[model samples]
Target: MLEPEMVAFVERTKSLYPSDRAVSTVVEQRAMYERLAAAFTPPLPDGVRTHDAPFTSPDGHTFMLRLYAPFERERSSGTVLYFHGGGFVVGSLASHDLITARIAADTGLCVIAVDYRLAPEHPAPAAHDDCLAVTRAALDGRLPFGPLPASLQLAGDSAGATLAASVAMRLRDEGVKGVRGLALVYPMLGVEPQSPARETEADAPMLTLADVRRYSALYWGDQAGNEADGADSGMRASVSARVAWTIPLEASRYDGLPPTLAIGVEHDPLRDDARLFAERIRAAGGQAHAPVGKGLVHGSWRALATSPGVQWMHGEVCRFLSDRAAE
Candidate 1:
């Protein structure tokens, strides 16, 4: 059951999104997202300490890193290196402000939300490079995650999760294994060119396949020299002999990964994406979280402060993270 707050949350959503229905499009989609984001306000409290600092990428594009830690840091745990999901185009740390703050409070860890360079301006390796760079910096010196657990959990929803995967792969490639865990939320794992399922879910609420197409164009470009294909389309290159940017799919390729938990929403376009990856992790001999968020939707975890579904979903997330920390 949704918390009582969820009722009001749904009502407010109805008022804000007249015909909250997604439509088809390949252009002008970014403007549509900007409109939706402008109207959406997450109701969270104040007094949470946050710092907006700039970090440099290997390619030299500057990223704005927002650190959200508890006001009372005397009792902090570890840290969550998060990437904001906007399909590599639209979102930033500011857009996910309340979500990051709540993660800090809920998971008992400082959440570092990275504002990676977006597409149409900076593409491919630019975004992935920033995520990798920051992860190294946090584990190296800048962040206050003193000798963090052998593994720092990398997390994010949608595009952010994709970046997190990239970071994990890079770390593995460089023979680094400091990541404690990974939490992925309905990650976009492939280059959805003309997949039948993608075409079918073209009108998912809040995020449409059409919107993804436009964002893909902006990120990967037209494919005819516009996109940094290898960097943007992570599926194009294998991170290892078996797994690429994702955990695994062939069931036999899931070795050497740290503990992992993947959360999926029933009413999301990316539902199967999470399920397939978790299955791969389990097949590879790593632990995978239970059934993906039952009866929930994409973006539910981030909606914890306002929506009922979000509270339930995040409760499960907290439980999963707590269990991992205990292990």
Candidate 2:
């Protein structure tokens, strides 16, 4: 079934495209992202409206956010802070259009996808800090949407997944509460890339070791407050790369953090990363699990319009959010 699905999936993806791609080197990685982005033109559902608006990051680079909302539906379960997964360098809200809308529609939630600065450009703390700033401001004092539920959720795929954890982690560190849940879709949580998922799916068709290396190479260093200098990142030969850019959830205790949902793909390289993080979240005295797409591949949710895995994931994420909202 997976093989047949992949065959059909590739056959159908002959024309989709993404709007942005991370590019540490405009000559290589960036160009690769552009091609992938150009091939990701997913069609969103009928009531979903996409918009670009300015957001202020703590560092003042004029951050932006992309929102996916059901224009006619005034009702929402809650607002979701989304981050796109592109190995932290490529991937914009556009890359995950189908997934984002499916999330909003299925969960009955409004999704605000943070256009956080990517790696090799706005690396390390910049992306992390921007996400933190947006989340904190979004949920401050007054009700976020004119007296609606002020609760929020952190949602991201791949690189965005890392930021999701980083954002929640920072918030937890800062004593900020009220997050309903954290949903990481095949997240890239490790800086060293030694997860079994990478070894197991070393040659998975949809994603590969090359993709990982490229993504890592793109996100290989810390670009803290250096986007304007035209600086290129330099990889460190250190013992604590994890401390700089990785989300070591395995070491964190979920004291006041919200419940978490870690999604993985059987045929993707980041599967193990998701599994490991989820287990740690549970160990930390919070709830976490890979809601039922274990047989699928990375970014399966992006194919929600075409695959059973994605559709099932859509429903599962909503149920998770709603169930947690009740808790």
Candidate 3:
């Protein structure tokens, strides 16, 4: 059963975006996604300062990097590379500014949120390449931060979490070390259509099976040379071929991944993605814990201000990062 507040929130969302009309075109869909993200994002917290900077990927693709710094009394706790969630098709620094700011304030860490290139226009490998390049730069102390600490962590929500996990896998594959932890919030690991959660939560609020297919198609369709709708073109085949690292859940080896906290919602279609990933990490002899929120739906993080459960989850994430930093 969904919480009353969550149920109301879902109803409001449905009202805002009625299912009667089809959202045509990439522009229309992207606009709807941005509006949804902005609607749920709360005001920026006090004591948190944010500024934008320019970052260039290894492939010469330049993008904006939003830095959220909290006023720490002593020294900074650590640095976190935050990737905003929008299913790789939509999302911006503004969309996730509040969450990033909260992370910085709660963790006392300098948070650099990457505004990676979106897909369908930019396509696959574009977003992943940019994320990987930025992650590499952050790990190498080449980012705006002057000095590095041993407590660097990676974090993201939904599709962003997929990217975070992928980057961790890539870094591990390359023998790059010093990544202390990963914080994944309701991640979408591009699971097969027949997955149990897909069948069980077919009508889950915020994200349904149709929404999943639509978003996946938009990001991985054209790149795979499929003329059909992004969803019609089996995403797994195209996405896996374009960038195998993007599919962290199916990665051949997960032995070297750092301690990870995978948080998911009870009714989310992607809940299995988080749980199975954590299980895989543990099976590989790594530390990975997944906590599923009771009666919550997908994208509950958006209710950070209004939902006590979400607020508590935020604190848990901060605590996880801090504890890993101390290790």
Candidate 4:
């Protein structure tokens, strides 16, 4: 059964977004997403300090990075590199300002939000490379994050989570150390459009299978239908396999990864993506915990202040980050 609040939330979204509306171009879809984000994103809490900096990707592309720090903290609990979700196409640091602020304040952690390039213009390696570059910079203590963090972690929501997972894989392969953990919220891990949750939540309120396919097409580029013959697509598979990080679930290795926490929403098609990821991590001898928000829908991070269940879930994430950072 759907929660009454979620049902009403869907209705309100429909009134503004109109399910019948059609978006043919990436520009249109991006505009629609920006509108929704602006309308629904909650206000950032008070006592959180924010600033922006410029980061140049290893590929020489420069982008803006936003940092959120808890107010008046004598020392931070830790630092986290946060990637925002928009199917790798639409989100910005501004769209997720509330989430980062709350995380910084709640966990007493310094959160750095990356404004990576979007797809259908830049595509797969574009987003992935940008995130990996930022992570590398952070790990090397070159990102101007004040002082070296006591511990560092990677985090993201949806597509951002995918980036974090992939980056973690690369870090593991490179023998990089000091990454405390990863926190993935409703991540989009692979091209499994026929997953069970996809079948059951075909028309989930906030996100749908069609929406997933659209985002996949945008992010994965021409590999949208090359799943069966990964060899025929040559570059897509080769680049994605250079390191097990590209498609984390299909990675050749999952051992030696830092602790992980994956959170999923019950009505989301990607719910099992989180479940299976955690299961695999544990199978590979890494600590992992996945919690599902029953009676919730995708994109509920926007409801952090409005929904009691989401608030509790956010608290759980804070607690997890705090515990792992302390360890």
Tens digits of per-residue lDDT for model 2, 1-327: 364554566545434322232233544654564565545555667677767778765466677777777775456557788888777776665666666777776666677777778776765556677777788877773322333345678888877888888778767777778788888877777764546766878876566777777666556443222233343343332323434434545344555667888777778877778777777777777778865364577656645556777667767777877666555
How well does candidate 3 match the true structure in TM-score terms?
0.90
TM-score leader:
4
Write down the TM-score of every candidate: 0.77, 0.81, 0.90, 0.92
lDDT of 4 by residue, 259-303 (tens): 999998899988899998889889999999999988888888877
Superior candidate under TM-score, 2 versus 4: 4
Question: Which one wins on lDDT?
Answer: 4
- The CA lDDT of each predicted structure is 0.63, 0.66, 0.80, 0.82
lDDT of 1 by residue, 205-261 (tens): 555676566665666554423334456445333323222332223223556666767
The candidates, ranked best first by lDDT, are: 4, 3, 2, 1
Q: What is the alpha-carbon lDDT of model 1 when measured against the actual structure?
A: 0.63
Q: Which stretches of candidate 1 lie over 4 Å from their true place?
A: 1-47, 144-151, 193-200, 222-253
Model 1 per-residue lDDT at 218: 63
User: Which ranges in model 3 have alpha carbons more than 4 Å from their true place?
Assistant: 18-22, 148-150, 191-194, 222-242
lDDT digits (tens) for residues 74-124 of candidate 3: 377688899989888878998887789888888788889999999778766
TM accuracy, model 1:
0.77
* Model 4 residue 105 lDDT score: 82
